[model samples]
Target: MTGTANRSVERAFRIVDELAENGGGRVSELADRLEMPVSTVHNYLQALVETGYVTVEDKEYSTTTRFLEVGHRQRHRLEVFQAVSDELQDIAAETGEHVTLLVEESDQCVIVAVQEGPDAVNLFAYPGARMPLHAAAPGKAILAHMPEDRVQGIIDRQGLVEMTNRTITDPDALFEQLAEIREQGYAIDEGERIAGMVCISAPVLDKSDEIRGAICVCGPQSRIDEKRRDEIADIVKRSANVTQVNLDYV
Candidate 1:
């Protein structure tokens, strides 16, 4: 690209950021903040206003409602959100427990979607939150399905920081648990991430058998007890399978 085009793009972004940070900005104020000429700032502001991405009122420029429209459209377009939206609600309703979808990102568990049960407790986790990859049931479900190199990289970078006494602090023990999870097709977190909480998770796979993500049911130990462990795991496994099937169809 030409130097003029690159510089214009940079100046436009600076103008937008300056306006956003200051709530609104006049051409002179934007120029002062960005250390660019007032005429250049005005040109970018006009372009933004004309494109419907920005608006001017009382000679001040700011972002428009177009951003909200873009955000809503982007949320609906997410593949993971589409795959799990209805199923998470169904799983929560069926099991009477919290349902969550987690994906592995940078060796950590990132919550992508969540559905609370009727008797919801004060869960610390939520969508967009990150958790250690060695503690939660959803984390184990993801780790067990990850490639060996990826698992090793996680261990090297983020040594399993024990959140509770039950959390696997030893690398060898964690690997053993992952092996068991692989064999059983589900993982269990019995007061591991948080005391008095038990979570059961199963891996969601794609058509290529690659790990897509994990689904979990979380509740207090009394509700997710020893007698109900397998039952909860079976339900989780079913939901996971349905997610994969949905992905395939998509």
Candidate 2:
């Protein structure tokens, strides 16, 4: 494509991303943000509207339902979490600890599903929570199973930000920990992301043995003592395997 055409496309996408970030915007606001003229922004907005990518509500422009439809379709195609929702809930009930399903997205872990335990303890994880790839058990478990180059790229992009005293801030040390997790078939986050919380996670693989996602059980640190930690790890690994087998059938 010509340089001018590429720039136009880039500007158009920038407008859309800005709208998505701000929830909505007016023509003047978009033009000011893009450092372009109002007429140019209006033209792009009109094109987006015609393409069913943006909508104008009460004179404020916002993303259209088409974007949501696209997101839904994409999630449906990657329905690993949906297929194992019930099994994860059962795991939480059996273990009396919160269970979470997480998928890696651009070096971050997105919680797709969470089932609260029957116990009174509250966990920090929830559906839609985005966690750093190196600070959480689910993130580390998925990272350990990912290709080395990809993992290194993530570390380069998002330096291991320390969330607590226990969080791994050194890249080499973190890589060593991930290597150990790869050998052990599971990962542990001992108050790494949140103080007083502990998470045990295992990787879920598909029929091709590709890492799809991860399943984790999270609870207070006091409950996951030395003796209980082993039991929790066993249950988390079994649950992950069960989910993987189901994914293989599908």
Candidate 3:
């Protein structure tokens, strides 16, 4: 695409993202935030309105029902997460660890659902939390199944930052680890990103045999020792498989 055309598209998307983040805003407010002329913001808003992506009322613009429709479509397709919510709760209860469902959102990994264990723990696995694609176990599991070029692009965009001593700082080493995780059909976070925490994750695949998301169990390093680690991996893989199976019916 031409430079000007790409810039326009980026600006349009920026406007939408800003509105989505702020809930709603007047044209002047949007123009000030976007650092563009009010006329330009009005033109963009008009285009978005024509496309049913945004709606304006009382001189304030907000996302339209069309945006909710898109979100609904995406959520409907996430049958696997819904199918295994109960099973994940069981896993957390059985293991006394946090169980989470993670899905790839563009180049990032987003936690869609979480079930905390009975035991009081410092770790927080709340839904809507985002993690680095290469650092966390669920994110690594999804990334392991992605194409090489796509993985490279993620690394290029979000250069691996050292979150802890165990975090992988080298891109080449991370790729090697991803290869191993793909072969094993699971991934591990050994004190990476957060110190004193360990996570095991397995990928969920659709009927088309495409990786959709991952199921994970995370806990403190003190509880998840060498033996418990293997047990957690096995349970996570089984839970992920069950979720994938249920998606077939849904």
lDDT of each: 0.86, 0.87, 0.87
TM-score of every candidate:
0.71, 0.78, 0.72
Name the runs in model 1 displaced over 4 angstroms: 1-78
lDDT of 2 at 99: 87
Q: Is 1 or 3 the stronger prediction by TM-score?
A: 3
Q: For residue 176, what is the lDDT in candidate 3?
A: 98
Q: Which stretches of candidate 3 lie over 4 Å from their true place?
A: 1-76, 120-122
TM-score of 1: 0.71
Pairs of residues at least 3 apart in sequence or in different chains that clash in candidate 3: none
| lDDT tens per residue, model 1, 154-205 | 9999998989999999988988899999999999998999999999999998
Model 1, residue pairs in steric clash: none
lDDT of 2 by residue, 8-72 (tens): 99999999989988998999999998899999999999999999899987779999878767766
Which residue pairs in candidate 2 have backbone atoms (N, alpha carbon, C) closer than 3 angstroms, thus clashing? none
